[model samples]
Target: MENPIFKDMLVLELASVLAGPSVGQFFAELGANVLKIENAATNGDVTRNWKLTTEPADTDIPAYFCAANWGKKSLALNFKEKEELQQLYKLVQQADVVIASYKPGDAEKLAVDYETLRSINPRLIYGHITGYGAADDRAGYDAVVQAESGFMYLNGEPGGGPVKMPVALMDILTAHQLKEGLLVALLRRERTGEGQLVEVSLLQAAVSALANQATNYLVAGQEPKRMGSDHPNIVPYGSVYTCKCGKQLVLAIGDDRQFRKLCTILGAEGMAAIPAYATNYSRVQHRQEVNERLSQLIGQQDREGLLQQLQAQHVPAGAIYTIPEVFAQPQAQEMLLRNGDAKPGVRQIAFKVQHQEQAQLTPPPSYNNYKEDKID
Candidate 1:
């Protein structure tokens, strides 16, 4: 029977860890049969033990592995044996795509580079997810990429030392770009009946994902500073006012009209009437003064009261929430943030698949679960 999404395609994933595994994850969700090939000596992906929230009652389940390896089949292979390498080459010949994340020349050393794979299957889409491009020797960890891309410097408070983002934001961002690159190659292959190499670098992806911060620094000579919560160009566009309940809300007024509406909500009519606060530019110039006064005014109200009032005026505002509080939110629940349990033997965790209808949950397989079956 022809598949609804990817009918004839098979994905051979030699990628481990987050960004590389994420590429296979996307294909697995969209009806592609994905075989995740892992090394047997190290016993598979390195991310399996990075972070574990719950102690596994059985063999330890790596929660980090669970986040990136869902929706795919795992197979263990020891390529040091020539027979195993032969088996891998046969699988590559049958696959529509092959994705790997080895260093620049490592894949060639393994005899699994694009040239060798394309010879096996000329129609194979080979994706190389690397830390830097094929030319760079520097290592490419998420924090390393963040610092190299100038992301770490532009975040946090002004004049403070560079702060590393807690999560692997650069890795996740590269995963998104990897997915895009794979999909685009798939589409192109569909039209042309030919496959090509798709390459994504951690440093390049991080730089691309930095958005306007990178552009502003490149085009204009000004380095983007860490302004805490406030926007560089827009006043009243950040965290403001600790409420009586001690909850902080971000009040982002993009223009003067919104500022006036915020003023009316806070009953600061006199402050809105001031000439220096009339325009967004003037307010931005006097942002410290504006933030101080707004903080004082909103401090008188409770969080619930301030949120309700601001929302009623169609202002863009949101209260700072802990992870649990965010999970409890109706909007987050609707968006599938509370994914519950993915499959048997997998503990419940939040997956970032936003669309409920499109979301498919499956537990990450154990590293040793994939064993070779002799073909009849």
Candidate 2:
């Protein structure tokens, strides 16, 4: 699991919370030396205090903080202090990258601006994340961005109120965008022996993720509506049906062939012959009727057996699984990352390289103190 692809790389992280730290962890997983710089004035990253009710009150390093803070060295410094500022300058000399999440004018005020750091190290790649954009200094939270980006409006049930996703999806998406930008920047530097600034904003990332949903609005003027576990374009694709065992199954019938096969499997070939449900377009137009018929047919059989039969017939169908059920599977268990006695975490890197069986994840950094012993 030891892929030292970035073993010689040095990342100086001045970012806090998820997006910036998540990028740091990505490099750390690649065997880079990541130095996480937190502000002493604020008692370090606020996420350190974002503990669940079940967590111990006396602890500063909560589960939320550890989520994206592993495999890095931490430093809490008052940047205004001359000595503390000098420490950062020294790291800049040897750092390959600097990750920051400062507001519009705050970076300049704190002297950690990209212009200032790039002046010290011209070849240093600066990755910056913002809530809105450079023009706006409004603080960005994932929940707020989710609402503003049209995600919340399209989520949840058909008639239900807007609902923010359970996870910090915007931050995660922004981190991924920043990572792709940084990687491309690194590739550009390799070719030209130069470095540049890479920027990502939460609002932009969430909007970018709208993908086809945005296109449907722009191209066809079809305003997206909330349809729980349902797709706008494809019928039977995300439609959930309950079985006799009370278990749920969902179908992803992508083509006419699959739809016909689904009908054959459910002993309802007659339904597919009915001119209205003949094609995907017709099925979409008659969504209610199709769903009701499928519900009745599926309800006559057990979920597990029906799912197996559908798969055997090349029909895309699966059973709904709870979070516990998800991790209980072998493939999910294999994605778990464990370092010492820390609670199990899942790896962010999903794709595998040739001959790469696992990832080498280290322990999360100490909340604020610098661990000189951890330095190689």
Best by TM-score: 2
Q: Which lDDT values do the candidates have, in the order given?
A: 0.77, 0.89
lDDT of model 2 at residue 338? 88
Q: After superposition on all CA atoms, what RMSD does each candidate show versus the true structure? A: 3.6, 1.7
Which candidate should be chosen as best, given lDDT against the real structure? 2
Cα lDDT tens digits, model 1, 1-376, are 2333653468888988778887777676665677889987787787766765465644434656766676567887777778889989988877888989888888888888999889888889999988999998555788888888887887788778888887888878888887788879889988999989999899999878877776677887667888877887788887656988888888888888888888888888778879889898899889888988988988898999889988998988889888879868875665342234643222122343343333353567766665555211
TM-score of each: 0.89, 0.96
Could you tell me how far off, in angstroms, the CA of residue 40 lies in candidate 1 after the best superposition? 1.6
In candidate 1, which residue pairs clash? none
- Count of backbone clashes, every candidate in sequence: 0, 0
